[model samples]
Target: MEILKVKHLRKTYHTKKHEILAVEDFSFNLKQGEFVAIVGPSGCGKSTILSILCGLDKPSSGTIEINNNLKFGYMLQGDNLFEWRTIYKNCLIGLELENKLTKENLDYVNHLLDTYGLKDFKKAYPNNLSGGMRQRVSLIRTLATKPDILFLDEPFSALDYQTRLAVSDDVYKIIKKEKKSAIMVTHDLSEAISMADRVIVMSPRPSTIKNIYEIKLTGKSTPIQNRKAKEFADYYDKIWKDIDYHV
Candidate 1:
């Protein structure tokens, strides 16, 4: 089912001297359980599109239609966990702020921590965890809200290359296992191809859709395994060329 639809989306910014257009003629649809990734050059407004979709900011033009009763979860660039709080408490913070710290919700959070290998460290602070473990905790925090559609903005950008690979695969599995639809914005073409069901390429600056590719791997599985697919490199090259990086 189509859970979200965006039509002719445009966003502009105002300054003392002039107006700047951040996005231009953007449109896309996100279906249930679909993993979509948006990639473009730096400052191409990829993150801007995410902010608009998640209602953090308003678009200057166009409309976004979402299925009724759908809630959103966001995982930003860094893990953004507090050093002072235990991992379990960090996960519950969202529910606490939303006034949803009920018994049922508490049980769900515990289940996520246990299921995702964080049960042993629930009482540990964020500073003691490895980078990958920290990212998992961050994901659990986002999932704690029980959101239907999750928006990820450069979610693995802060990690080192090896950790980035492992964490991305882990995250891909977590999102799929939870059966949540996701729209991720990243500059890494390989990451986008390996992690997404579909990859949308955007133009630089005043962003617009340049191309969208439906990824098909021979034995499509985890993001890491997907890297070895026969068609992966071809898709990467095509997307690399389609991106307007030089402009």
Candidate 2:
């Protein structure tokens, strides 16, 4: 089933100097349970598309139909955790704000906390945890809202190389285990190749769908392991060339 659809989407920013066309004729259909990655050159409007989908921004022209009744939860480039709140409190902040707190909801939150290795650190502050743990908490907080779709905007970009790889694998597993659909905007070609079932390539400024590549691989592996697959380099090389053309 189609969980999300974007038809002829366009977004333009009006400025004193000129009207910048950030996104143009963008369209795609996302399947239920699909993890799709969109990659492009920097300043190419990848985040614009994510922002519009998450309802943080509006597209100047187009149609977006999200099939589910639940709202989306967005994760930005950084953890965005509250310094004042404890880790557990930060995770439950969404429920408290929505006035949706309940015993059942709290129980569910506790279950996620324990399942995702945050149980011991529940009382700790965000500042005490490592970057990866903070990101995990950010995701758990997003998940606490019971969102039907999740929008991730380069959530792993700020991490160190080794931590990024491990965290990417962990996040991938968590999203899949939770049975959620995600749209991730990233510039890392290997990341796009590793975690996505389909990789959407965008052109430079005034971005549009350049192409979409289907990835076929077997077995479960970390992003690093996935990168080591025999066909990995071939896919990498092709996407590298495709985006290199625009750069």
Candidate 3:
């Protein structure tokens, strides 16, 4: 079933100098349980699209029709965990914001930490954990809200190359295990291919969908494992070409 629908989405920024069009004629639909990645060049308004979808910004013209019953969770480029707060406390922030910090919700958050191997470090501060572990905590914090759809905006960009790879796998596993639908905005072609079921390629400047590829790898595997698939290189090359052509 269609969980989200965006039609003719357009965003314009008006400054004293002139009007700037960030997104134009953009439209897409997300299915339940699907992981979709949006990829484009640096100034392609990828992040703007995400902000509009998640209600951080409004579209100038067009419509976004989401399942009214669904909730949203956003994970940004940085982990954004509080330095002074313990991992457990950080994870509870979301639930607290939504006023859903009941016993049942707390139990679910604890279960997520335990299932993801962060149970032992619940009392530890974010600084005490490795980069990957901290990102896991950030993800867990988002999940604690029990959102129906997740919006990931370059969530691993701050990590080193190796840690980014490992953490992507960790995140992919958690999302799949929780059966959540996600839309990720990324610049890395390989990362997009590894983690997404479909990749939406956008054009530069006033961005719109240039191409969409349905990723079909050989096996059920983690993001890192998917990177090793035979079709991985092909998908990478194709996406690279598409972005390259647009730029």
Best by lDDT: 1
What are the per-residue Cα lDDT tens digits for candidate 1 across 1-247?
9999999999999999999999988999999999999999888898889999999999999999999979999999999999999999999989998999999999999999999999999999999999999999999999999999999999999899999999999999999999999999998999999999999999888888999999999999999999999999999989989984565
lDDT of 2 by residue, 137-237 (tens): 99999999898788999999989989999999999999989999999998789998999989999999999988899987666366667887888888899
RMSD of 3: 1.4
Among all windows of ten consecutive residues in candidate 2, which has the lowest summed lDDT? 216-225
Clashes of each: 0, 0, 0
Candidate 2 residue-wise lDDT at 99 = 92
Candidate 1 wrong stretches, greater than 4 Å: 244-247
- Distance from true location, Cα of 28 in model 2, Å: 0.3
Which of 2 and 3 is ahead in lDDT? 3
**Regions of model 2 farther than 4 Å from truth:** 220-222, 245-247
lDDT of 3 by residue, 39-116 (tens): 999988999999999999999999999887799999988999999999999999988878998999999999999999
- TM-scores, one per candidate: 0.98, 0.96, 0.97
Top-scoring candidate (TM-score): 1
- Sort by TM-score, best first: 1, 3, 2
Give the winner by lDDT: 1 or 2. 1
Q: lDDT of all predictions, in order shown? A: 0.94, 0.90, 0.93
